[model samples]
Target: MTPIGTQELDRELKKGSAELLILSLIEHRARHGYEISKLIEERSGGVLKFNVASFYPLLYRLEERGMIAGRWVEKAGQRRRRYYKLTAAGKEMLKTQRSTWRDFVHAIQVITEAENA
Candidate 1:
């Protein structure tokens, strides 16, 4: 079984947060899957890695949901790569999701504090 702890749970939350983060990134500029993975790792001080095992399914599912679109593009980098860009729906959805998640986390923290008090 997977061990759960503060950091582990935070990491778990990140998986769910991945969609919003990816949308936020694509809002700035489109990127291939690997690029998205790399940015998350870099921006998070190497803490967040959307490595292939964790990243691709999420990407494919987002495409399946019509939230993002992917296409193959040839690059100077070793070989061709599949890039992802946010769709109109993805932009709106991300805004809604980000707000909800923030509120949820805030509420949880508040309630937990009250209980402790």
Candidate 2:
């Protein structure tokens, strides 16, 4: 098998965590696609970025899976936008994913620390 380069590894890691990131973002309130994208970029300090082609598909997939609910909102003098919020299933999934993520990170940290010792 071909080895994964740094860029490919980064992409894979981002893909693995994308659902968790999205769920956490909308846990409190609903957010439109653009808002979500910008928030992710800003919060990550531009280390992570998602364009329309890649992002919308993930949103659609989550909506289809019942993890998220999206509704169209029309504001005065503005185009209609679909805002997304976490569903009950999403909340449950988020809880589980967060726990798993913490455990995985801790394990990785332990291994790396031991290797450096």
Candidate 3:
């Protein structure tokens, strides 16, 4: 049984980490929306999932903010899919976000460990 506070914390953590997760996934290459969703689920060991309704808007928002760029691509036999890639700004954002997340986790660890000790 999960406590209410724990559930709330889970939601907040997911909201805060969504951008970093998405940005890191596409740091190396462009990926379509579904592929990104699958990777997140797989990599998280089924602990995290993003549906299209919420996921697409996040992608569009990132694109609009110039953190990412999207273009339609079609393979020889496949339908066109809009793939997203990190922009120069996104690389910088990723770097900053990575540092921020690391600091945040470290702080949480210190506090929790101090409380336990």
Best by lDDT: 2
Question: Whole-model Cα lDDT per candidate?
Answer: 0.85, 0.95, 0.93
Candidate 2: residue 31 lDDT (0-100): 98
Best by TM-score: 2
Model 1, 30-65: lDDT tens digits are 798878888888999977776688788998989999
My TM-score estimates for the predictions, one after another, are 0.79, 0.95, 0.91
Worst 10 residues of 2 by lDDT: 47-56
Candidate 2 residue lDDT tens string, 1-117: 999999999899889998999999999999998999899999999988986899999999999999999999999999999999999999999999999999999999999899687
What ranking of all candidate models by TM-score puts the best one first?
A: 2, 3, 1
State the displacement of the C-alpha of residue 2, model 3, in Å, after optimal TM-score superposition.
Answer: 15
In lDDT terms, how accurate is model 2? 0.95
Please write out the lDDT profile of model 3 over residues 29-83, one tens digit for every residue: 9999999999999999998887688899999999999999999998998989999
Clashing pairs in 2: none
Candidate 3 residue 111 Cα shift, in angstroms, is 0.6
Which candidate would rank higher by TM-score, 1 or 3?
A: 3
